[model samples]
Target: MELLPVRPTIKTPAQAFTGDVYMTPIHSGTGPSRMTVALVRFTPGARTNWHAHAVGQTLHVTEGVGLVGTRDGAVLRIHAGETVVCPPDEQHWHGAAADTFMSHLAMLEAKPDGGDPTTWLEPVADELYEKANQQ
Candidate 1:
């Protein structure tokens, strides 16, 4: 057994996120393992761009409240200690609720061939985001 070295937190790029978001690497598996995990923190009204994962993704909320929405206009409100699973290749976005900060463990697996697992699309429009918050 070995203890992994801690990685510095990074500010999520504006290309794929809105508002202030940060990510701390947790685990990135190698070789036989393909799992990846990160602790993602979002400030109030912050959220990710529309994206989809080749192998699906899971978010376990660790603090405050969050919102997860899909292209079908379905939005789910997640609270601390809750977990949400997004199906593979299903366009979606997730982030902090309008009035609170949020943190979650973002877990997903890399593509088997070692390619990027996520396909990031356009940012979630402000109107859609506001509608989500109102729901």
Candidate 2:
């Protein structure tokens, strides 16, 4: 097997996130492989917009605390070394809790035919964010 080339880290865009965030692509499979992996970091209170993966996604927390909220109003608190699996097309948002910086590895799968792997929706509202933080 060949070593993957090094790539620059990418700052998350304001349009896609609510607070300070960044990501480093670990492996975006080429050729026949359909997997993508990234190391994502979020500052306290930072979070992604609602989104979903075409195939599915798995997140493994590596440091600090994380919050994963689902459309059905389920908010899961994930600590370091914990893992969470989000089913395919299941809308959700994930980020750092209000009091800590957090980092996680997100593993996602692309569609077999090479279409868009993720569908990003609207940002999480302030009310929802507050509600989550209060939990």
Candidate 3:
């Protein structure tokens, strides 16, 4: 077992998210491991754009409330201790509730081909986001 060095949390790029978001890499296994893990934080109303993973992704909420949405207009409300498993290539996005901050552990696998594990799409529309966040 190897102890990884500490990594600084960095702001997420605006191109891939809305509002304030940060991520601290926990472990991003190199070589043949291909596993990626990180602790992500989202400020109120912050969220990622529509994206999907080649090998699916898992999110374990660690603080506050969160919202997860899909292309089908389905939005799921989650709180601390909840875990969401998104199937491979299932377009979706996750973020903090409009009135709360949220933090979660995100886990996924990188393709052996060295391509990006997640494919990002357009930002969630303000109208769509407001409606879904009306809670």
Q: Would you list the C-alpha lDDT of every candidate in the order shown? A: 0.98, 0.93, 0.94
What TM-score, computed on C-alpha atoms, does each candidate reach?
A: 0.99, 0.96, 0.96
Model 1: ten consecutive residues of lowest lDDT: 1-10
Query: What is the per-residue lDDT of model 3 for residues 1-135, given as tens digits with 9 covering 90 to 100?
Result: 888898999999999999999999999888979899999999999999999999999999999999999999999999999999999999999999999999999999998798899999999888888888875
Off by over 4 Å in 2: none
Model 1, residue 24: C-alpha shift (Å): 0.1
Sort order, lDDT high to low: 1, 3, 2
Candidate 2 Cα deviation (angstroms), residue 73: 0.5
Comparing candidate 2 with candidate 3, which one achieves the higher lDDT? 3
lDDT of 2 by residue, 15-120 (tens): 9899999999999888788889999999999999999998989999999998999999999999999999999999999999999999999999889889989999
